[model samples]
Target: MASTSGSTRPSALIGWRVLALVYDLWPVVAMWMVASLVFTVGYTLSGHASRENIAPFSALQWGLWLVCWLITGAYALLSWRRGGQTLGMRPWRLKVVAADGVSAPGLRALMLRFAVGTASLLLAGSGFWWAWVDRERLTWHDRASGTRMVRLAKR
Candidate 1:
């Protein structure tokens, strides 16, 4: 394990910011997309597709959405909580941490961050695109959660 003693300022570059998002989020998003399709299909099949029938989300349909959200949420929370990185991030040697660069975030922190991330995606993904324009290359969720994705220093 590697440790940095003093200040824990992040040294990851802008390029890595873009790369990290692409690498870490693509599979996650893909999974969510597929699950969403399945949920849509399942709801439609169950006669709950229209707003009149499922405007507030039928029990079955809501259950499916909840399950899907939990799965993705677990993936994000566990990855960051356990390794400070997702599978995709690990492959690219990227790690996420608090601004102070601690070992790993606590469970509550991870969950909060994940919730913020979810909200960002729900907002038409302008949050994701924020990185492209922000000086620090941070997305809205990143700012809201006080988390930073950093590149693990080479051994």
Candidate 2:
């Protein structure tokens, strides 16, 4: 474990960030499954047939997508608020903090980070690749949110 005690922590590299994202996918998928189950139950209870799946591009399907998004965001925001790391980040000793590298980022910043990160993914990770050329080695989300991901030294 790493302590958020000093300003000397190194910024996390793209590889570490990608690894954490991959690891985080497991829990996120689990959450999405649970959300899907709830939606399925609600849909069935609303007089829909038991075997019917949410129709593609229908309003109900869109609502389910939105719910899943919110659920994922809640998982991320709450984890970041409670501690600087998510389950995946903990393994890599990655911590999210203010740009100065020692304090927790505010909720607004975390939200911004999440939004931009989604955009980054949608754009085929151009924003993440930008870090390779950025002077500060920051991704779009990091800059937009005024947050930095640091790799803490091993204990």
Q: Which of the numbered candidates is closest to the native, going by highest lDDT?
A: 2
lDDT of 2 by residue, 1-155 (tens): 12354544336878999999999999999989998898899999999999987788999889988988898889889999999899899999888999877889999999999999989998999999998888777899999999998888768
Lowest lDDT sum, 10 consecutive residues, model 2, at: 1-10
Model 1 stretches astray by more than 4 angstroms? 1-57
Model 1 C-alpha lDDT per residue in residues 1-155, reported as the tens digit of each score: 12242324434544665576677667777787888778777777776644444456668667867877887888878778777887767755777788576656667777777898788878976777777777766767668777776666556
The C-alpha TM-scores of every prediction are: 0.65, 0.90
Error of 1 at 112 (Å): 1.5
- The residue pairs in collision within model 1 are none
Residue 19 of model 1 has an lDDT of 74
Cα lDDT computed for each candidate against the true fold: 0.70, 0.88
Which consecutive 10 residues in model 1 have the weakest lDDT in total?
1-10
